[model samples]
Target: MADYDLVIRHGLIVDGTGAPARQGALAVSDGRIVAVGAIDGRGETELDAEGHAVAPGFIDVHTHDDAAVIRDPRVDFKIMQGVTTDVVGNCGAGVAPANDAFRAYYAAGMGPILGESDLPWSTTAEYFAAVEAARPACNVAAYVPHGVLRYNAMGGERRPPGDAELQRMREQLDEGMRAGAIGLSTGLVYAPGAFARTDELVALAKVAASYGGIYGSHIRDESARLLEAVGEAISIGEQAGCGVQISHHKAAGAQYFGMTKQSLPLIAEARARGVDVTIDVYPYVASSSSLAAMFRLGRGAAFETAPAIIASVKYNKERYEGKYVREIAAELDLPIGEAIRKVLQDEENTPSVIMFIMDEADVRRVIADDHAMIGSDGLPSEGKPHPRLYGTMAAVLEKYVREEPLLALEEAVRKMTSLPAGKHRIAGRGILREGWQADLVIFDPATVADVATYAEPRQYSRGIDYVIVNGEVAAEHGRQTGARAGKMLRRGVAT
Candidate 1:
């Protein structure tokens, strides 16, 4: 009998640890890597990878694919970009331990992608069980959503939690951590979670820290107040004694085009002060969010305006949807408030805007920073989605590492794999060492490129010829191999 289930021979291995690339073969047994050097052995299967680069499968640290995972387990958008694992429940939104009422509340933003029958579980544990049962195309890890937790514990009302409410929320967070959440995520720009005072977040984060969980956030603002938001996240990390991850790190809006330089220093200072602060960013300049977020500066105001905006006929103008409110108001000859309302009407109908906010120099500077990791803040539901969903990994490999030479290949791979895995405590992943899980990708760096554009968003990327998830072939020759071999990852004492 063969000593191993599979062997990939003669490939240039970039182990995702920021190490120098090596020319070698890799052996896999069961679902874990057994060897990482020359192995002249008989095997159940052999894949020739000569001249290709084999690295740890890319881990997308930030994504909004909660419903899409159930609706389409293939995860074509990410898989095509060489992503083998995606951490969902980001930006304080997810689908676990939620009832029909909660589902109805978030339907506009999350969509009705998963049917009641499709969701056979409710709690995080049960949700993972269902994911395991379904056998997805890529591994899925999740964070406990602060928005969902607050909504579940305190309903839609936004107020500082009283002693009893705070205690109850703490218990709920504790339960979620025990049930497999990697960390706690908050959306300070979105409702309920936005309503939470900084003290309440610090209190909940303390519980997460006790359980070895990190604290991540979609900050209160990505534009004018980005510096303050970063400061607040750093403060929370300090006060709660927890690691912090700033989700979809960016300085949006023309007003803050070059503010990344100013904001990133706050993160660096926090790290210098002994707080473990990190951030993730997609490759695209345009951000994706509910149309409502553009109009309302605060959470409650956005919620109040969403309905009336959807009702207006003037909102059907697609040309104005992705632009800024002031520009739209000028073009429509309407007041700023009315223009904002007109744009936010139906969440689905409201064309997801692509605000050109960040300067190219700023993008390069932030992404090149050692403390940063790659995150495709990609939402799969939008009709004309951001290209990052299908282009993130390829963009990094092709643009940053190859074309611009802003980052070395090994350094870029670290941002995509090990950095995120280490930050989130994902075990047996993000590395290509012996005894690790055999989640790997083989691609041609010279030819790898992102084909998807904002105008043509559904196109798959190029040059990623093979992707293996847990020792199973998920994508072959840039095409899905119809393998649903992914698993649900849980938090553990050691990773």
Candidate 2:
């Protein structure tokens, strides 16, 4: 005869702990899970989930929605996917702690992701404040960008930090940690961060480690010398005494199709040697990134030789929105290299392209790893964006779990939820136990599928029924109920 605000009954519960599903009812009150199992309770709102699988809401461990959340607080693309939280500022690009002098550099690195928007927050604390004030639809945790730190410490300088400069960067990293950042992220191939050597990253990692923060890296190379990059990421974690997360873990280029075969062992060995390590991958064979990533992946020659490399946005939308680069070159009677140069040399443009760089076997190899988790690596503001934005979680459930039977539902849920929360140390979420935060999703596993494709990239996933965020039914029956119950989940700060 207990009272509750809401109750979901008769559902198969996948609790995000990699435990087997059990039939039960979950009760919620005051935005926290109050009861589970055979609930001898009643509530104002009751949901009959007889045929659905209920699990703790998904957590996107890697994302660039730092500015997208502020601009589009509804965040349908996320909440609809049952993602109750987003971990942003990955790939070492964030928009915070930027002074008037250094803000431009931060903006450049973040501009493609955030778009051309006025950045009012200059520190991690302010960024948190803005997100809270806007009342985002899902929870958000952040990592301070190493690229921004380097830019602030040395403006536009492609050189390793000297002693004084390194100390300065360390101070800023410490400030961000104190401001509630969960960790520090590095895009080792990007400028500023690219200029940083292992010793330099180790120095910055030490500052984050002192705060019990993790180090997430978009490693230097994922194509030719991927093992070396993986080795370096492991080296940073070992030397700095911080947990390491390899972001968007993938081996690009057909020549390097099975590189993860080598990379995974490095991680396993690192873990064996007491270096905490994990990786994330989206459930797609094709990867999308800036033209620069393609260039660095040694696909520059292919941009001219191949037509499948299509221009997605910014430079020429009229003639190249849905066509391949080679097609554009053919129509214009221009050489492939010259056609690519036209797009790349345009300073005003930040174009993103979708390249068929990964093999399905290679993608499956990475995602099937025990140490691997899920990250959409979705680019909201930039380019046409990847279908993973709307499709990643569903695709994993549909393609990997049910269709292929490559992964169990429990383990997949574990990756999207508890695994990430444990790695990032995000408390009070990722599990559906009593006293935990009430972020849950109800979906029809039988029909769960990703409808979004490369040709039409903005479609939402299928079979997601109800999404509850902090005990509020945010999205019910596949549509947003206009509830903004999300909070800024700080590391040590409790709401």
Candidate 3:
């Protein structure tokens, strides 16, 4: 018998550790790396990787592919970009602990993309069981969504949790952590979760911390109150004694266009103060969200209200379908609020908007910072979804490393792999070393580029020649190899 199942020969390896690249061969056996550098032994299979760069498969730290994975495990959007693993249940939205009532409540917002037959599990663990049974194309990790916890414990009420209700939520969070959730996630800008008091979050996050779980948040504001949101995240992390990650870190709106510069200092100070603070960013200027998100500020309503809001005459008159609030208001000769209301009246008619609120310089600065990791924040269900869903990893390699030259290739790879794996505590992943899981990628750095654009969002990327997940060929020659070798990563212990 051969010493290894496969050997990739003569490749320039990046190794995903932010270290300098070196030429070597890699050996894999029984789903883990057996050796690195020269291997004189023969193998059952050998792939000639001469002139290619072998690196750890990209791990997308933040994604909203809960439904997408079950529906189509191929996940061409991620695979084509060399991503072999993705952490789902982002923004406090996911398909877990799901009931018919909750499903109905979120249907309009999440869309009709999911089938009733698709969801056969409830808790996070059960959901992963379903994924395992289905055999997805890439590895997946999940977080306990605070929105679902609050809803399950408090019945979707828009008020501060009473002592009893708070305890129930804490117990539920504890249960999820025990069931293998890596952390707790909250969308403080979205309802029910948004209605939660800071103390409630602190208490629940404290429970998560006790179980070794992190607290990740979609902050209360992305624009005007960006600093306050960051402060709130810091406060929660400090009080809860847990690590905190700001999901899709960005300062939105023209008003806060250059505010990332101001916010970075606050994050730095918090880190200096010994609070574990980190951030994730998708490489894009435009953000993707439901049509209702554009008009539902301060409104504690379920996603079901979206379609009705879009059908209103005020929305049509304002022409808020595909344009930003400022742009629509300008065209309609109306106040921003009026334009927003009109846009909400015809929710289904109103497509998701691409709000160009972030500054390119701010994006570059965040990605280059050692404290930040890359997250797609990509919602795949939308009609005109943000291209980041398909282009984020490629964009980082092409734009930041090659074109704009903001970060070195090795550093960028680290942000996508090791940094995120370390943050999420995914063991034996994100590194190209012996005894590590054989999740790797091989590509041509000179040719790798994102082909997807805002106008043509679903196009696949170029230059990712091979992707290996769990020692199986997942993508080969830039095409899916119909392999389903992914596994659900559980946080083994609650923290």
Candidate 4:
């Protein structure tokens, strides 16, 4: 008879605790890690992990995979890259609490980034249940997206919420929190959410705080107004008395190059003043978002100098997919702004883009920050999606740890695992401790690398040898096992 369910032996353990690496064997039993270090017990199944790095499975703390998990339960892009958990409903965008208004919003040009789906629920609890019914390959946690709340309550009204609307939004957030949402997230750069004032945000943050949740934000600006935006996020947290997470922290645009130097300090100073705030960044120089929204936010200026590649378009797939917008404009014989308007109108304002705007130096600087964690921020849409969706975790190990060596192997694992697990309150996972859930990744650190490129963005990653979720092998040797061991995690509750 086997003494344990599984045992992985002789690998270098980087236990996701920021601890020094050590050679050891680990044992699992009934979906929990029963032992770490020397393990003499025999197991029903075993894997020899010699010469590889065995660490906790990566936790993607920021993602927009709310619709992807339900639409395609396999989630191969995340699992193949060794991500065991995905925190969705990021940047205040989600398809949850699917009321009439939310359904209309999804139909009204949100499909390019959020993916098209028939929203089947009217509450966050129902949404979580739907995710569970789909049996995603990785665990999922979520935020009650402020944008959805606004749309549900006010229906795209571009003004401060009236008293009745404010209360309605508050009630929805309360319901989501009771259903185990991790926090309240706002995309202040996007409309409806953008229309809200600071005090309005403070009110909603208070609701999340009451449920012991944090506040995450895609701030009002990431360009010249970055500092002001950062201040507002901090103020909201301080006033609401909750922790804050700043999503995909970067200064985008040529003039704002290297602005993280200033923004990072501002974050540090806020911490000194008793603000509980942290940041997450993707390991890429380019960003992707809805073409119409960026243009409305005055981000189109960057497109004038740096060509923007159309990542997805419903109307003109051959003409726009994977082509630069500037090239499209050249063909049409129109100015850049006019061309963008024409295409947006034709596509029903649903096309997304990959815009090269950030500096590599700034990306390195932000990633090197001890308080900064990693998130893919990848939009899971059709037609040439950003490569980060397929490659973020692997890229961190290959580029940031092995190639340029910005972070030590153990420290980087901490950012991906325990750092996010602790901040987001994902209980009983993210660390390889006895009695913890057995979510893990075994990989050859030397060979681990992201093969997905901007041109070939959908390719799977390389060197992730095995990905285990809750003691079941979900993927092995770059292939999925068709085992869906994932769960929908609730705040402060073990899966």
Report the C-alpha lDDT of model 2 over 286-372, residue by residue, as the tens digit: 776776556655687656443354536665676676567778677878887677666666634466777777778878988999889
Give the C-alpha lDDT of model 3: 0.79
Candidate 4's displacement at residue 156, Å, is 0.5
Residue pairs in collision within model 2 = 97-122
The CA-based lDDT of model 1 is what?
0.79
Give the per-residue Cα lDDT of candidate 4 at 253: 94
lDDT of 3 by residue, 360-476 (tens): 878887887789999998766534467888999999998888887988889999998999988887778898999999999998888889988765688878888999999999988
For model 2, what is the alpha-carbon lDDT of residue 493? 56
Residues 1-495, model 4: lDDT tens digits:
999999999999999999999999999999999999999889899999999999999999999999999998899989999999999998888998778877987877786677888898999999999999999999999999999999999988989999999999999999999999999999998977899999999999999999999999999999989999999999999999999999999999989998999999999999999999999999999999989988898887888987689999997898888988889999999999999999898898999999999999999999999989999998999999989999999999999999999999999999999999999999999899999999999999999999998888998888999999999999998789989989999998987
Q: Give the TM-score of candidate 1.
A: 0.90
lDDT of each: 0.79, 0.85, 0.79, 0.93
Clash count of each predicted structure:
3, 1, 21, 0
Q: Candidate 1, residues 15-88: lDDT per residue as tens digits?
A: 99999999999999888889998898967988888888999999999998776776678998888888999998
Top lDDT hit = 4
C-alpha TM-scores of all predictions = 0.90, 0.96, 0.90, 0.99
Worst 10 residues of 3 by lDDT: 304-313
TM for candidate 2 is 0.96
Cα deviation of 456 in candidate 4 (Å)? 1.0
Off by over 4 Å in 2: 106-109, 302-311, 492-495
